[model samples]
Target: MSSSAFRTVPASADVVIVGGGVMGVSTAFHLAEAGVRNIVVVERGELGCGSSGKPIGGVRAQFSDPLNIELGNRSLRAYRDFPHRPGADIRLDTVGYLFLLDSDRQVSDFAAGVELQNGLGVPSRVISPDEAGRLCPYVSTDGLVAAVYSPADGHARPGLVVQGYARAAAHAGVTIATHTAVCGIDTAGDRITGVHTDQGRIACSTVICAAGAWSARIGDMVGVDLPVRPVRRQLAFTAPLTPPAPRIPFTIDFSSTAYFHNSDDGLLFGLADPDQEEGFDTTWTPHWLELFRTAARHRAPALADMRTVGGWAGLYEVTPDHNALIGRSAELPGFLYATGFSGHGFLQAPAVGEVMRDLYLEREPFTDISPLGADRFRHGAEIRPEAHVV
Candidate 1:
């Protein structure tokens, strides 16, 4: 069907991903590489042009949930070996993440997580304030008692990573049709039928709701309500200073509620605004800038002298539990979800795809993904992660 057509034509497939962000593209890439070629990825806008584009590129294994810990660990390996796969040369910067611990309880809790991560083969370790400064001297170690540092964790170019997945999926015979918005879903006898898109109706046996911020609306199309809500996050960067300090590691200042990493030529930074921040709105305000400045001055006094370049707002599809709702949706069979990631979607994409394919196609995954099931939420089983430095 052509874009000029008034009516959307129908195309058949095994799966239809509704969003073209890293979550959707990465899943398509993994599934296609695993031999599931009958897939169609429909995006409402250009590839990697959503929350994925605005992510501060903070990747770490500092998670409370064991599932997320395992997932992030696996994704790290994939990023390291991404170039081995044809066309997935997304440059993932493994610069490590240093999270400052402001309170004793916070320090003790993170120490426990560090112990758990290390036991699970993740090289996460707890360090003192001096050690934090040793890791990055730019940090203000005044009130910082301890910090969690994981050299194995890092950040990648979000847009390039999404493009890598989309391209890889395309090369593997998976159709990536961007700028093709999926308006609603078609359903039949207790199962998914097809997807109604701007281009045409794509008929698919399995419908994977990878539409990040729009997952709830997509779920409603099939008469099921997904408890996913979009929370707005604004990110920005400063002009480059003289000779970069070996690309500073992803830093999280717990006291300031701030986190930042690299931005190609400049230092990307962001913080939550106490006065104005939340809900589906992605608008940026001058007060938000003021809050970010307060954080920068407290964490890195040097940044106070730097000039603000620009920034943008993106949404985090947060679930009630702050964990992603993966696996099949029991309310709608043949309908799977890869949404409600809060903000961990990009880092968890590769592992998520692997697990999703293993569950949907192979019938059994290596690990138990039952915790991520939507039913778990209703059952009061939460997979709340430890790394809450959003």
Candidate 2:
């Protein structure tokens, strides 16, 4: 589809998806492929301007939870063939993911995680500290008891992935309305009848909440209190060195919650601060610069001399269990959730799109996603949070 294809929004659509991030666009793409072409995606900003734009694009099936592993595996398959399927090059370099462990407990825990992953058809393994060093030589191995390595886990270009989905969705007859804010969900009784947006009311029965950090507010428009909060995360890009950093897998120092990897021009790194407050705040904290430096020096001392060229802060749509809440909302009929992916939404977008498509069409999903339902929390079901989140 050409750029002029999105000149206007239709008065009615078969499906009205709120949010134009990767999740929303992916949902539209899969739905269109399912023969549900009368789909309209509404985004308050440009496509992928939300958390999807700032993602590090880590794709992996090394999760401890079975549902996460399944989602990752399905997404990994899609991403592997994305260049052909979506016709957009995401620069998917499968350099692998290396998680450095510094304690015996972590080693034992990850060993079990690897076993579980392997059982689920993921070839993740726990490796020795020496092997970890061999895999990512620049990262410090001091005090490291062991490591978990997933050769199939890797990174991709986030912007390209989002664009790929958006373009494919548009080509498949999905209408995308940018700068369109959904002010409210027009519902009759317990069923969604349409969505009232800044532009106008779009009459549609099915409403998908894929608004990332702003998902809770979207749910509120439908009288549903979604248990999703946004937390600020900062990532920095270093100046391109003469030889650049050695091409290494996305490596994480587990104990310190620090991670770094080689990009096309330089090194990209981030650290999780325990002091981070929950909200929609994306302001960069001055004190975090020192923390990041300390983490880099401790984990990858080779990055010590590299000057930070640029950095940006983004939001993580966090849930109580640090996992995503997918599936239909019981209270609000015809309302579906494709939000609260914590920090793993980019990698899990493909699988989520397929699953949401199946559910919206009232067909049995390819994989059972009942475990990711919001009802789990409502019914006091124990939420099994994914252990592998960076």
The top-ranked prediction according to TM-score is: 2
lDDT of 1 by residue, 188-290 (tens): 8887888888787888878888888888888888876678887777777777756874577788887776777777677777876544445778776545767
Off by over 4 Å in 2: 1-8
lDDT of 1: 0.77
Q: Give the TM-scores of the predictions, in the order they appear.
A: 0.93, 0.96
**Model 1, residue pairs in steric clash:** 64-386
lDDT of 2 by residue, 131-244 (tens): 998899887887888899999989998888888998988888888898888888888888888888777888999999999999989988887777899888888888886776
Best by lDDT: 2
In angstroms, the error of model 2 at 99 is 0.5
